[model samples]
Target: MRKTAHRMVWDIFLVNMIIITGMPGAGKDEFVKVAKSMGFLDVHMGNTVKKYAYENNIKIDDTNIGKFASDERKKYGMDIWAKRTSKYILDEDITIVDGLRNYEELEYFKNNYDDIIVIAIFANEEQRFERIIKRNREDDIKSYNEMKSRDDRELTWGIGKVISLADYMIVNNKSLEEYKSDVKSLLKTIIDSRPKIREKLGL
Candidate 1:
């Protein structure tokens, strides 16, 4: 009976992968935070880029970070970030990857994992701008024009397509508590449904 239980646990771990996609300031970070609290191993693609920047002594500002991401994509491939991030996922039961920007990244996860789910968090332009202002991250855009420009750049990377194609969508235009509640509920559903999902997928 102990052996059977151990095998079931391993089987579940082998099939759990959640990939998160959203635009900047859309609460992707918050969602990943909640997932981490629930014991999911969180991987951020932006962190991978930031780490690369730090390692190479590149300026970690918004323009330099964006340029570095673009240059790496052009140099390595469109899925360069995903490739780098995947290496860090080591034997985690439920791995939640944040910062999926394009279809290529999505496809990389899909091709590699048998059971993969994508969740996109969204907020209105005004709401996202407000969050950006409130958070005031060093890499965040300062003006409306800058925000729009960043949006255009991410859209050009096919973030819109990934957002539209997500298995689940969370609109985060409300209170933080409400958003956290919604995320908790969604995570519960995903965790509870994993076994049935694996069965259906024959994993």
Candidate 2:
């Protein structure tokens, strides 16, 4: 079937999406913030999981939420989170998806979207732990042991494989200002290099 005029226009203008995958506290949130400032909409997979748990009356703790996500993956396949989160994605020029934890999820988006780029943010374990402790979100790991356990759970879900397969990798081990600068510059380059986006932005 031929495409509608609106569909053709969307295809012409939108740059599609960027997938952000990183371990907990690897600055995925910061990356989203920068992307948002650059006019990209975002859908966070973790928030999707948490919202599902909330509506189901499941206690919103790390363990319960993790188990729910894992069980869903086991039942529906490894891309379950991606399936759920995709509902929240908007038809924007560029959408940044955060909290991608596994290879199947990556493949789900790649198979569905026309243009997708996966970016992995990396920080050494020590740095990640320090940042997690400093940030102290309610669901964050409270100790090194808990962080280790969380890492193991994520690895079991194939996060390491996804990270290894990322199209771009950003090391977020420096000062926040410097890291933000690097992220901004890299995102700008990615956006500017897109032919349609370049024309849209008058570049």
Candidate 3:
């Protein structure tokens, strides 16, 4: 019984978490899709906020959604989004958290999880803008000025700092196939590193 209980504890601690941080339209969704295909459970912070807004009947436009997210941070502290989204994490051995926008959110995961990896995806502004335009999500800004404003807002939330401090970075400025290949390689590296991590933990 003692050995079984100890093994259970080790298994629990062995779970690995990957947090994805990037500017809007920087291929985070694509990364999440790849991570999902690799069997990592996905939790998107922006989707959580949007769900909350929909539940409360808040307008879901770009400005309103941004304000709602900011208000949530102000009301519940800078880690509010992280705290809220964390509830979706289950007993999965690997989980991919997408849409981390601030350093406080990263800090929350660092303080809570023993095995956490931060991956940042980056693209040139022009590339990102073109992707955003092509995606045409209702909440996306329609103009370059609006996109710039959104970038400023996100940067103010410490996204740039989070990206700078990432454990790994994927530059998504190339073709789709190239980006996907890079993501797949990174995922394999992360998955391959897990056994070493478990060994070090005496699991």
Residue 137 shift from truth in candidate 1, angstroms: 1.7
Ranking by TM-score: 2, 3, 1
Query: CA lDDT, every prediction?
Result: 0.82, 0.83, 0.83
Error of 3 at 161 (Å): 0.9
Whole-model lDDT, model 3: 0.83
Across 9-75, the per-residue lDDT of candidate 1 in tens digits comes to 2322243688888888999889988887777778889999999989989987777888889999999
Model 1: CA > 4 A from native:
1-15, 196-203
lDDT of candidate 1 at residue 83, scale 0 to 100:
77
Pairs of colliding residues, candidate 3: none
Better candidate number, 2 or 3, judged by TM-score: 2
lDDT of 2: 0.83
Off by over 4 Å in 3: 1-14, 196-203
lDDT of 2 by residue, 1-203 (tens): 11334444332223377899989889999999988877778889999999988998898777888899999899999999997887676554567899999888888788766679999999999999999999887677889999999999999999999999998999998999899999999988887778755554445
TM-score per model over all chains = 0.87, 0.89, 0.88
